[model samples]
Target: MYRVMRLIRRFEERSIELVHSGHIVGGIHPYIGQEAIAAGVCAALRDDDIITSTHRGHGHVLAKGADPIRMLAELTGRSTGLNGGRGGSMHAADFGKGIYGANGIVGAGGAIATGAAWARRNDGSDVVTVSFFGDGAVNQGVLLETFNLAALWRLPVLFVCENNGYATTLTVAQAVAGSITARAEAFGIPSVSVDGTDARAVYAAAQAAAARGRAGMGPSFIECTAYRFDAHHTWEHKARVRYRSDDEVAAGRSRDPLDVLGLADEVRDRVDAEIEALLAEAVAFALDSPAPDPAGALDHLYATGLRTRDGNGLLDSAVR
Candidate 1:
């Protein structure tokens, strides 16, 4: 778990550097402080279990076993990316690894996870689906409706909410009326809140919730309370958003998730060296890869390989 968290931290840090150097375009939402939640939750999940991620999702994808090289390539818009450079940072996906995709929508992944759980149940499979979202998603009607449906159908779904105390710029205290767990309990789904910085605590909660799903109990909810150590997005680094005070951010950083690892100094140094080597290779691979060709832009747009029709009702002769 600690190793996974460390990898996620370094990956995000390198991604930020790439953004600054223009190797990775359009910026990214750094997952520096929220490593423990993704590491712990994914550590508890089976290899076959499914997960749906949010816009701030690089950590989740890495924890769920994505190749860092391909992921970085995707972020850099290289043709060798996980999604052939089409999905980019926000939509990086590996279906064979049970990761559906990192959605750009705020709370839409909940519905997708619920539907996946329902389908898996009908197939007589014990597979569970996890939906990872932020605090902002709790207020979305689609997410609430998904909660209702998951509970009503007793679907094997675990709704993991990474509440970093803000919905973009709006603080959770300022925006969320009542508690986050109460919202899930309103729908009769068992819910719990855990210290998001403590990977062990998050792991315990996730294990219990996953067990409930596997035992055919129903959907469960876990609200992970952590702090975002960096900007909501890389753009904010340049925009210089002033929502958080320096002291508050300091307090948050003091409870660093990496501190919980407690590894020996020698072990830590060895692990750090290994991670640096791996990241160096990943960066090289991403930079060396070619960009996607514009002519093949619509290649994987549809599964059926259907081509668009021309204005005169004839099939377009382009190389679809």
Candidate 2:
């Protein structure tokens, strides 16, 4: 878990460099401080267990066993990307690993997770699904509705909220009304709140939730009170947006999740070297990959394999 958190931190740092170099076109939501949350929750899940991610999702993707090289390629819009480069940073998906998708819309993953878990249950599979969202999602109607449906059907969905005290620039105190966990409890789903910076705490909580889900219990919720050490997005650095005080930021940074594990010098050094080499290769692979051709742009617009037609009732391929 410590190694995973460190990898996510370094990955986000490298991703920022790529954004500035124009290799990755768009600015990304840096998952710096929230690395422990993804690392911890995923540690309790099986390889086949499904998960849905939010816009700040690079950590989630990497934690769920995605190849960093291919993920970086996707962010760079390469044809060999995880989603053929169409999904990019906000929508990367890998069905084979049960990663439903990383959604750009706030609170959208909850419904997707519910549907996936219920579908798997009907198919006679005991596969569990996790929906990761931020505190901002507590107010979304769709998420609340998902909680209800998940509880009613006893769907094996785990709701993990990374409450980093802010929704973009707005603090959680300013955005959320009542208790975040209370919203899920209203749906009769068991919920717990834990310190997000402590990866082991989150792992223990998620393990209990997974056990309950596997035993035919309904959905569970975990509210992790964490802090975002960097800007909400890479663009914020350029925008120079400042909402929290320096003292508050310092207090939040006091408990560094990467340092919390207290790994020995030898093990930590080994992990650091391994991650550095891996990321170096990932960067090279993404930069060397070519962009997809525009001629077949609409090729995968349909999942049913139906091709779109051009003018005169002919296929677009005719022009190519």
Candidate 3:
């Protein structure tokens, strides 16, 4: 858990540097402060357990065992990237690792996770699916609708909401009307809220929820209340958005999830050195990788064995 959280923290920090250095285009939604939520929850999952992530999802992807080298390459638009340079930061995915994708749309992953759980159940597989969303997603009709279906059918889906108290600058107090957990309770789904900074607490809650799902009990909801230590999006750094006060950010930074696991000084130093060396190699690999060719721009856009039509209605050999 400590290693994962530290890796995420350093990775995001390095990504921010890359953004400033012009290597990573379009910037990233840095997952700096919310490391423990991803690390702890993923710690409870099996290698076969599926997870759907949000736009701010680098932590979740890394926690689920994605290669940092390929992920950084993807962020830099290199062909060697996880998605062959197509998905970029917000859409990188490795299905073999059970990461469906990091969705750009808010609340979209809920349905995807539910569908995955339902399919796995039908396959006679005991695998569970976890949907990681934010506080902003609770009111999304799609998520609520998924909650209804998941609860109604007793799907093995765990809804993990990373409630960082804001929906892209809108405070939860301003946006949420009532209790965040109550929203899930309304659909008769069991729910719990945990300290997002405490890795142990998150792991315990996630383990219980995953166990319940595996036992064919039904869906569960976990709301992790953490804080966004950096800008919601890297663009905020240049735009200088001032929705959050400096003092509030400072106070929030005090309870950093990365520090919750108190490892020995020697152990911390060794891990830091190891991660630094790994990130150095990852950055070199990303920079050395070539960009995708324009001629094959349409590749991977359609399903395999599917054909396309040209203007005259004949099969498009170019795509074929």
Q: Give lDDT per model, in order.
A: 0.94, 0.91, 0.94
Residue runs of model 3 more than 4 Å from their true location after superposition:
305-320
Report model 2's TM-score to 2 decimal places: 0.96
lDDT of 2: 0.91
The parts of candidate 2 lying over 4 Å away from their true place are 311-320
Candidate 3 worst ten-residue window by lDDT: 298-307
The per-candidate count of clashes, in order, stands at 0, 0, 0
Superposed Cα deviation of residue 12, candidate 1 (Å)? 0.5
* Residue range 190-280, candidate 3, lDDT tens digits: 9999999999999999999999999999999999999999999999999999998889999999998867777788998988899999999
Model 2 lowest lDDT segment of ten:
311-320
Model 2, C-alpha of 225: deviation from truth (Å): 1.0
What is candidate 2's lDDT per residue for 27-61, written digit by digit as tens?
Answer: 89999888889999999999999999999999999
Off by over 4 Å in 1: 309-320
Model 1 Cα lDDT, one tens digit per residue, 229-281: 99999999899989999999999999999887577888877888899999999
